[model samples]
Target: MLVINALLRGGIPFIIMGGIALLLNYQEKYSDAKSTFFASLIVFFVGAATVIYNIDHWSLTKQSVVHFLIMLITVYPILLLSGWFTIASVFDALKVFLVFVLVGVILWIVMFILAKVFSW
Candidate 1:
């Protein structure tokens, strides 16, 4: 879950998809340990960068356009890596977009519920 969130926030789904492709292409030559370690490191850096950026840019008031723009910037690479640029890949793009939206909604709902329950 953290990895997925990190990938979403970092706009680095291509890195993850590429790593998966590499693993599948050379499963016999590469050990799971190496792949996992490298992937974890990449995710760590990406997640850290996202946190830093958010911390520096956060504002009390909401701006829908800014939020949308940030989301678009984060999602473009993932869309490209998922092959969403081709006519045949329109469904793929929709799927990825839905998944992202669903995950975000779920996270928000969970946070809201938890806050209510805990009085936070």
Candidate 2:
């Protein structure tokens, strides 16, 4: 199925990245079971969410907007749970949102250029 394929493609990387993040943040204190559980949950949603791209009728902009929103909605909470940031005020949340959006835009541009260059 397309859904399964999408999950496998995106979910695997998502889970892998979770592991990498755990390793990278070695100095931080994270309960192994809790972290693994959260990582699995996050990866499952992220991977499953990628199936939105298969909606051929949707414009690229629409698909992208939906996907970006899904990522932001899903990933941000998990990042917070993982102790990545402590937001004490609305400004903190806005700062994080802006940074996330900025990084997403930069990555999108890079990928667009790479796709054009490779004729993808």
Candidate 3:
């Protein structure tokens, strides 16, 4: 039941990312099989991590923090190794990290607002 729900949740992003990876490969943007594999894996982690939100007992803050940590640990390395983003210096790495955080916050806010409006 729960497992099936989680699988369904994760499967969408997995398929989407797989397609994107294939497209990138076809276009010769990132032809490395290893990079494609890692890119797909990153999306899997991201999609699966959404299960955290289903934890009703957890506060929103707790859920967001846990999800953020999960993504940072699981997705950051793959993005770097897959040639999605290059960080030639510490400053560049910091800039990338900041941009990641900013995007996450903006997306979170948008989703939160949509959820509230829809629930109302």
Each prediction's Cα RMSD?
A: 8.0, 4.3, 3.1
Q: For model 3, how does the per-residue alpha-carbon lDDT over 10-61 read when each residue is reduced to its tens digit? A: 7777787778778777787866645666767876877788888888999999
Task: Report the lDDT tens digits of candidate 1 across residue range 1-120.
Answer: 544565566556546655675776576644553445444443444453444324335662343344444555655444445332453567866767776567655755685587589974
Scored by CA lDDT, what does every candidate get?
A: 0.52, 0.73, 0.78
Candidate 3's C-alpha runs over 4 A off are 1-3, 23-40
Q: Would you estimate the TM-scores of all the predictions?
A: 0.39, 0.67, 0.76
Error of 1 at 36 (Å): 5.3
Candidate 1 vs candidate 3, lDDT winner: 3
RMSD of 1: 8.0
lDDT of model 1 at residue 120? 47
lDDT of candidate 1 vs native? 0.52
**Deviation of model 2 at 41, angstroms:** 6.6
Pairwise lDDT winner, candidates 2 and 3: 3
